[model samples]
Target: MEYEAATRHFAALGHPGRLSVVRLLLRHAPRGVRPTEIAGTLGMKSNTLSHHLAELEGAGLIGSAREGRSLFYTVRLPELAALIAYLGQDCGRGRPDLMPTHPTEIDMDRPFNVLFICSGNSARSIFAEAILRSLGGTRFRAFSAGTRPNSVLNPFAIEVLERNGLDTSGLRSKHVAEFEGPEAPRMDFVFTVCDQAASDECAPWPGQPLTAHWGMPDPAKAEGTDAEKGLAFAKAFGELHRRISAFTQLPFDQLERLALQQHLDRLGEA
Candidate 1:
């Protein structure tokens, strides 16, 4: 594949939600996942999961078939193999010693570690963490924590995520203090997804990561029928998806720290 084609493929796999789907398929390998199971597992709605599944299928990373009322999907192993081989198509052809390297030791797929903070960790922050991680893929590692975490995820959040067929397994609300100690991972970016978390003065941030406030409306606060709540969650996910897609496409190496920060500010506004 050409570089552009490869980049697009990588970009397609960038979202944390999409990556979750890809990982699931890869884990299952020869046996594909069915649409209903995917939806039920992720707490997503059937229609929304279909959209994400279609995107994966379009990227040539997955294949699907219909069995009665259900649709099954499988990871296309050969397609993944071809993509890997294309990355090294010209290896050692000229200066084998001159292969491009990352500016830092961290994997490009695992660009700056990200942490999303909020008060409850029940809705918006969880959405941000999952969507950003799935959408950003390995380009960034995303996590969520609350100043005072809830015991369980919001049911609506679970509903929407499952509808989109994202992996909701092993997810739990966490206290922000867990990330404040000396042993915490160095965060490249720290975002507060709610006003309270943004304005909190007691947070003991260690590394002074680039901090930003993204005041996303609470999905839990959404008042409506189940369908309405799902729509709100979907809207929030789409907004984050768009902003993040733009941010990830920028040439970070060419931008100064201040410029990059400014760009991120604009992204938050988006």
Candidate 2:
């Protein structure tokens, strides 16, 4: 199957809240569930739950219908089947012994490593690193770097992130050189988050990591009053959170190498 649709499906399932929502709905399939019931059971805010529901519907993972003034949602079994099949279609193509027959065979303990790069690691790249760690720390170890490293991280970025419940402790602006050698942690994925870095000369990462461009404005350079600048930081943080949240939900063990790379590239698109 084409990878774009699978990316959307994976992105939809990435959020912890949405993943829970889908599983709960799956248990009550056919009969379906109302928003109130879902929110009550999950102990989630109504508005927040609504947003998750919308995402699930958008990805074709769930469906909704109006039942006399109340809305009900159910799993889209066919679409779910399609996603599973796509992930396994190329599995063990020439190596039968390597195929995963059970979920336990998936090597999740070998956490994936990721690196985010930009001209200055004070804003977009730093935010991407933090958000991914916060959301997917169990499966990923994320790092950020700058070609032109700053003496310290952008204070405004830290302030805004802390206000939104993220810990800003120990995060510092780092030079890309720190991760360049054979002894350094090899990255499984590398993302360039600014136009300057995407086009500028840079040292190659050691592993030939899957790469993508997710260019965003340098919120650290936002020209405005503090409040306005904070708004810019928040906006950039939100976008990174969404993308990283989606990234963590992919079925890594199930997908073929080429298929997984396609999804990663599609996810970089705004």
Top candidate when judged by TM-score against the true structure: 2
Q: TM-score of every model?
A: 0.56, 0.59
Pick by lDDT: which candidate is best?
2
Steric clashes per prediction: 20, 0
How do the residues 52-146 of candidate 1 rate in per-residue lDDT, one tens digit apiece?
Answer: 88888888888998878877898787777667666555444435454433223223444678888888887777877877767776678788888
Model 1, runs deviating above 4 Å: 1-110
Instruction: Give the per-residue lDDT digits (tens) of candidate 2, residues 1-270.
Output: 468998999999999999988877754443457888788777899999999999999889999998799888978977987777776665335354544342233344688899999888888888988898799866899899987855468888888788879878778899888888778898888888875566455666665676777777788778879999899999999988888888899998898666776687677664
lDDT of 2: 0.79
